[model samples]
Target: MAGPEVTVVIPTVGRPSLAAALAAIGPGPEVIVVDDRRDARTPLPVPDGVRVLATGGRGPAAARNAGWRAATTPWVVFLDDDVVPAPGWAGALARDLGGLPGHVAGSQGRIRVPLPPGRPPTDEERNTAGLATARWATADMAYRRRALEAVGGFDERFPRAYREDSDLALRVRRAGFTLVRGERVTVHPVRDDGFWASLRRQRGNADDALMRRLHGPGWRAASGAPPGRLSRHVLTTLCGLFAAALTAMGAHRRRAGRAAARIAGLAWLALTAEFAWARIAPGPRTPGEILRMAVTSVLIPPAACAYRLGAEVALRTGGAR
Candidate 1:
């Protein structure tokens, strides 16, 4: 019996790794590359026979919707541009989908993130490695086209490449379809996004707020996401804000303000130190790594809280996108 027809849909921001991803896919099934770069003045160079669609930088969720919607096959596989499929992965994927029942809406490919052999992995490397066990990661996920249509595809409200996959998977499962692990594997390489990468990632906290609002506060448990330090972050942020406010108020009521400031300042210091140490303890203890952790830890709390608060406010005001 013939395997189900599959089309690989890759949403890209013109990363250099996109070419490698396409090459690793090796030209069997129909491939659609969604060009999601904000600037479309320069044409993306893709190999012959690979179709390209433009989303004008609406983000991964929108780009994916564009790619899968354009596909005519029964199966639409979504692959992140930074991943490399294992050799002969096309055949493995076919076999994975061949005997699946109609109720099986999706098949997830195992992801491997290669860390350095010598010495402990850095914080960034360890974070990247988490994708290996991330539930329903789109790094290499395949969904039956009909299931996608039934659920109305990905929610474009998820503007970034975070939480969108989990949200979709939860929705698909709730719609009465099952998802399973597949035999095929893909490699997700660790990226060097510079020193402030961790700080920048706090933007996802806003998306998390949206997840809670849409799927309820139990969304994390329902979606298999880890119980994150959001409560701790909120506490840290409160401490920081109280310390600053008390310090500023010291001009009028010197004695009372000084005592309040001292208490809040100590709480903020302890929280920040603890957060930094948690990250530093697990990885390489190089001075540079320590400094990055210390600095980002101080900022991440406030940044995360601000994002979540902003998203909540947006949701309340009908301004969330």
Candidate 2:
């Protein structure tokens, strides 16, 4: 069979990085850019050959779908606005897909965050580039047009920017199509700078719960990957809180108040040490960044867990509205 025509679909929210993304693509490929914002505030001038679509404030999933639907190509490659493909990325993608079997539905590429030395990633940066491993990132993922159509494209229920790619990938896999990782690479530059802004973005935890409700409890370890040390931190915090409360109550009953206090104190120290170490070892930092890390580290676990739990409950109960 002849190689499929490739249509590169990029969903953008008017980020300046879109230009870099466009410049990275080599010639001889159809390009589609979906502007999700839809605002009449003057669209950026795309390169002469690229087709642009405006979705008028719909989410990325919708933008992607629009781009794909508009594509005449048999294969649709999705790239995020912030991603810049490396040299030969398009050629590598063509070669990779050409080599895949008929059952292969999609391909993922490696994503790297080109961070400067001596600075730990900000919370927002971590959120954006944390998935740098060789896997599925919307920034560098491509899908067979037929396969995407078979799975009904991306689910619009994933309102905000999270887990929509995984949802689609899981669906494609369940439909008896294989999603293989490709040799092509892209750089996901970390653009978010504010600390608290990143924390507020944890609203995606609600979407995680939605994914779990749709896919089941195993979705966390399966689609979303493991919860990591954040789970452990939550447990430690609860244990310490329980011990402290018990110790205060036991003072009237002459229970082992001293032992309980010591345990609680040890737990607090352990938590702080874990937080400091997680932040410090990445690289050298000024006292301000270190201090910010320390504060955010202590707050991140509980905030994340709370969001996750709430999202899970809401999604399971169908109360996301």
Candidate 3:
């Protein structure tokens, strides 16, 4: 019988790193780059023998769906546009999938995140490092085309680069398919996404809400994610809002409001300080890092709670009514 053939699918938003990613793959195992830029008027510049598809700015889930559905090979591998495949990756991928039994639906590649040398990593670097042990991160994962078809590919409702892979893995497993770790490795370089990246990442809490609605409260354990701090965030956010409300109302001569405001204000400050310390404790404690953590820590709880609340309300109301 002929050996199993594989196609590589990378979803991109026109990042400059796509060029290096393509170069590292080096011309084996048919490659498809999905351009997810919503307003692209021109095609992405790719070398000959590489195919590019457009998903019109849909998120990674939709982009990957477009790529895999267009593939004819039995196996479709999903790679992030910023990751560099290890040398001889094509052959390693072949080896990883060559003898998989029918019940085995997917193979995951090991991920390595390179941090700065000679010092502990910054908070942002540490966040990126989490991908190294992330379960079923599509940064470097392969799935049998039939298996993908069976589970209906990624859930596009995720709308962001978080939690979709875990959701898919859960569904595939529930469908009686087994996913295994493979020897193939990929390097996920930590790109500096500016100072507010951590705060910005709180947007993923919305997806977590969707995950909860779809998979129930045990979704975190089932998806291999560490226990979350949503409950704490909710409390922190409530305290902050209550503090502000009471303080504002106190200006109208409400004696009880003044005392309650002090208590809520103290609670908010204590929670925010603890959250900041937790992040700063394990990171490089330079002045800049400390400032970033302190500022973002105060802001993250409210942002997370807002996103989660918005998503939950939307889910419960069918998002329209």
Candidate 4:
């Protein structure tokens, strides 16, 4: 089958990788590139015949919505600018949707993350590579246009790309459509954005909390995500706080405060050490990498706890309809 049934929608910030991404895709279906860069600083040069739309600094969820709505094809295929499609990807995508039942809403492409050679990957690299096993990641995914409209597109309230795709998947499933794994393959190359990327990624903690609010506690299992260690992060942060408070009390008191402080101090040390080593072991162990891991590990638990707490209060109070 030709690729006419599908229109490729790429929502991108001004990454140089977009050119290579377009190059790997065979010329058959129409491609719509959504420029998510709000500023005019870096303009994406569009290929001939490809349509370009600007979301004016709105995040990816809105950009994707714009792309698919503009498409007239029966199937709307989404690709991230950073991914490279395998040869014959167009046909593979067509085949993936060729025989699906009417109740099937979408097909997710298989993602391959290539790892660095020689030394083990750093914590950040390993995290990026985990996308290979991630479900409904939308690095490459296709949806029947009808099913997409049925759900009112993605929730713009997501405000970021992190859990937005998963939220859409869950809604599709709840609406009686099943999502299947497709045969199409795309390679998601690991990003090397220096030391601070992982720390910055902690912002997703608020998104995670929003997901729980929208989809309920079962959202992770329903969407095929791991249950995660939010509980453990909370425990770690609480232990550290208790240890700090006990240390202050121990200075003023003698017997009970000292024993309790010792216990809390040991617990905090053990948790923090475990967290640090989990990061340090898989690392490249460069001076910069080591320093980054130590700082982020200390910061991540508290940050996760804070963001989640903030999200809970904000969502419950109802910012907008």
Per TM-score, the best of the predicted structures is 1
- lDDT for every model? 0.92, 0.78, 0.90, 0.86
Error at 168, model 1, angstroms = 0.7
TM-scores for every candidate against the unseen true structure: 0.97, 0.82, 0.96, 0.93
Pick by TM-score: 1 or 4, better one: 1
**1-321 in candidate 3: lDDT tens per residue?**
134888999999999889888988865688999999998788788888998999898899999999999999999999999999989787788888998999999999999999999888988899899999999999999999999999899999999999989999999999999999999889999977998999899999999988888788899998889888888998999998998987776642676777788889899999999999999998889999999999999999999999998998988888521
Candidate 2, pairs of clashing residues: 38-56
Rank candidates, TM-score, best first.
1, 3, 4, 2
Per-residue lDDT of model 4, residues 242-304, tens digit only: 878877656427677777777777887788788888889878888878888888888888888
Cα displacement (angstroms), candidate 2, residue 235, comes to: 3.0
Ranked candidates, highest lDDT first? 1, 3, 4, 2
As a whole number from 0 to 100, the lDDT of residue 52 in candidate 3 is 90
| C-alpha RMSD of each candidate structure in angstroms | 1.6, 3.8, 1.9, 2.0
Model 2 lDDT per residue over 1-321, tens place: 235689999988898889999999887679999988858479676899888888888899899999999988878999998889999887887877886788998988888888756666654556565778624668788898999999889988887768898888888989999888887788887675665664576677767778877787787655646464556756766756666787767752555766666777688768767866666556356676667777776676667778888776766677543
Model 3: lDDT equals 0.90
Q: Going through the candidates in order, what is the number of backbone clashes in each?
A: 0, 1, 0, 1
* CA error at residue 189 for candidate 1, angstroms: 0.8
